[model samples]
Each structure stands twice: as C-alpha cells, then as structure tokens.
Target: MDLSSVKEALAEKSFDKIADVCDNLMLQVASKGTAFHDDWPYAIHLLGYFYVDDCDSARFLWKTIPSSIKEKKPEVVAAWKIGQKLWTHDYAGVHGAIHGYDWSQEAKDLVAAFSDLYTKRMFQLLLSAYSTITIPELALFLGMTEDDATTYVVEKGWTVDATSQMVTVKKQAVKREQKVDSSKLQRLTEYVFHLEH
Candidate 1:
C-alpha cells in the first residue's frame, strides 16, 4: 500500500474513501506471509472508521492493533478514545476527546468532519425523539455551550421558554428522495416470475 496516496487523500479531505483505503490495507496485511510494518498509519485508519460512522469496524481495528504500537503512538490511542466515547454514547466525552487531542495535520480535516457529522446526527435525533428538552441537556447532546445550543435551536425554529429554560423541538418534514432503478426492478421482477414458475 502506498502511504503517499493515503496522505494525499487525507490532505484532500476525501473522508468517504478513507475507510475503503484502510480496509484494503487491512486485507493486504492480513494476507498469508505478510508482516506488519511500523508505518501502517493506524491512527488514520481508526479515524477513517469514525469518519464513516462505523464504530464496529473501529472497535475491531482497535483490538487488532499491537499493544506496542498503541503504547508508542499516542495519536492512535487518542483516535480510539473518540471511538470509545461514541460506543458508550458519551456525547460530552466525544466532544471533549475531539477537542482535547492535538491531531496531526493529515488527520485534522477528518476529525473536524466527524465532529460536524456527529453534531448534525444528534440534532436530527433530538428533533425526532424529543418534543421538549432542557437547555443543559440539549447543550450536552449537541456538544455545544448552552448559549450556542440555544442559538442553534432558535435558528432551527425551536422555541425556548425563558422561565423553564426548556426548548421546544421544531420537527421538520424530511422529504425522502426515492429513486428507483428501473432495470434492477425489472430484473428482480423477472427473477421472481421465473421462480414462481
């Protein structure tokens, strides 16, 4: 595997392909007679999983990492801490882990993208799950300060009660775009007809 290509992808902030690159690297290393190398870029690999919201893969990767590498490379351990916080549903901890780490320039873009992706996902979850929630709780869930959270919710059209400090969630109707592949549907239909016969 070429480390330069991976570095290029990271420099370009091509997060969507990072996980696939790491997956390919893992398969290559796992091949018979293949030996582990010190320059595997495990930290980027782990962060790539988080970027794709694939915690299970991240957990598996963390387990396969050599203890010596984990001890020696603080960045890999730091990336895993983000995965741990995510796995445990510790929203506050997730924010803290992301902000606390001094990430390398290559990993910075993906890390910031993960934080934005997580915050957006949490906001969507809250919109559907809660009719009303407290300011502090909302702040914690959204990984923002109370003031910032309040301002964000207001911008989203949520109403905040000053006296109670409770925010009323404004649910937006999501238009799910359904694009049917006609050829695929036709093939499936033909297969079902043949099976019925």
Candidate 2:
C-alpha cells in the first residue's frame, strides 16, 4: 500500500478514504507482525480515527505501533498523550499537554479538531451533572459565547429564566406502573394450592 496516498488523503481532509487505508494498513501490519518504522502512516491513521471520534480505534493503533518507533517521533508521542487525556475525559490535561508546544502542522490540526470535540463532550458532562446553571457558567464550560450558550439551551428544549440568567433542564418524567401478569399470578395461585394440598 502506498502510505503517501494515505497521507495525501489526510492532508486533503478526505477522512473516509483515510479510514479505509488505515483499516487495510492495520490488517497488513497485524498479519506481517512487522512494525511501522516510519511514523507518517501511523500518525495519519491516528488522526483519521480521531476525526471520526473513534478514540478506541485510535488508541488501539497507537498501542500497536512499536515503542522504539514512537520514541523517535516526539510529535506522535505527544499527540498520543493528548489523545489519552481525551479518552479519559481529562479536558484540562488535554489542553495543558499541548499548550505552548510547537507541534507539527498535522498535529496542530489534530489538536484544533480535538478542541471542538472536547468542548462538546464537556458540555454533555455538565448537562448530566447540573439541572440548572447560569448562562455565563454554561458558556464558559462549553467554550462558547453566552449568546451561543443560550441558543444551545433553547435548542435542547431546556427552559431559560432570562431574569435569573439560568437554564433549567426539565427532568424527564418516568412512568412506574405496577401491573402483575395475570397468567403468572394464576400459575402462582395454582402452585400455592398444590403445595397446600
């Protein structure tokens, strides 16, 4: 397989093609029991998986690459560390790992992509934890403007108290009806009568 073609697809942001190439490359590497001495293919493959939000596959590929090869490529190693932070839902660690570091162009692009993904994931986590939060707090957590936060809350069908600057997540009502199965009850009654006799 031409690894250059895979890199080209990644540079072009043709993620689907990159995924296919990475899949084939992964299979080939597995069958041959040979490691990728070159980092480009592995790095691009990792980025492709990240683009599709397939962190599991990305981490799997990262682990499959030889440590000797990874050690030689600081950028790839750094990217992997950042990806690990993402997998563990440590957004602060992710940011801190890449902050002020000079990354390769590809790595920089990957980090940029991850920024949005992290924000979205953080928002989801916050939503689960808080029934009500101020718009400013929501905006800060989501890395969005207050206006955008308000819009997001509205879009999610949550109630907004404009006077209080708070968004309220209406709890979903769960129905818990206690109904016994008639046939099972009848069988139980018959079994009780049989035991009594």
Scored by lDDT, the top model is 1
Which residue pairs in candidate 2 collide?
A: none
Each candidate: RMSD: 8.4, 7.2
**TM per candidate:** 0.84, 0.58
Please give the clash total of every predicted structure, in order: 0, 0
Sliding window of 10 residues with minimal summed lDDT for model 1? 25-34
Residue 165, model 1: Cα distance from true site in angstroms:
0.7
Error of 2 at 27 (Å): 3.2
Candidate 2: which stretches are off by over 4 Å? 28-35, 98-100, 133-197
Off by over 4 Å in 1: 174-197
lDDT of 2 by residue, 10-72 (tens): 577666566577788767766898754574456656666766778888888887778776878
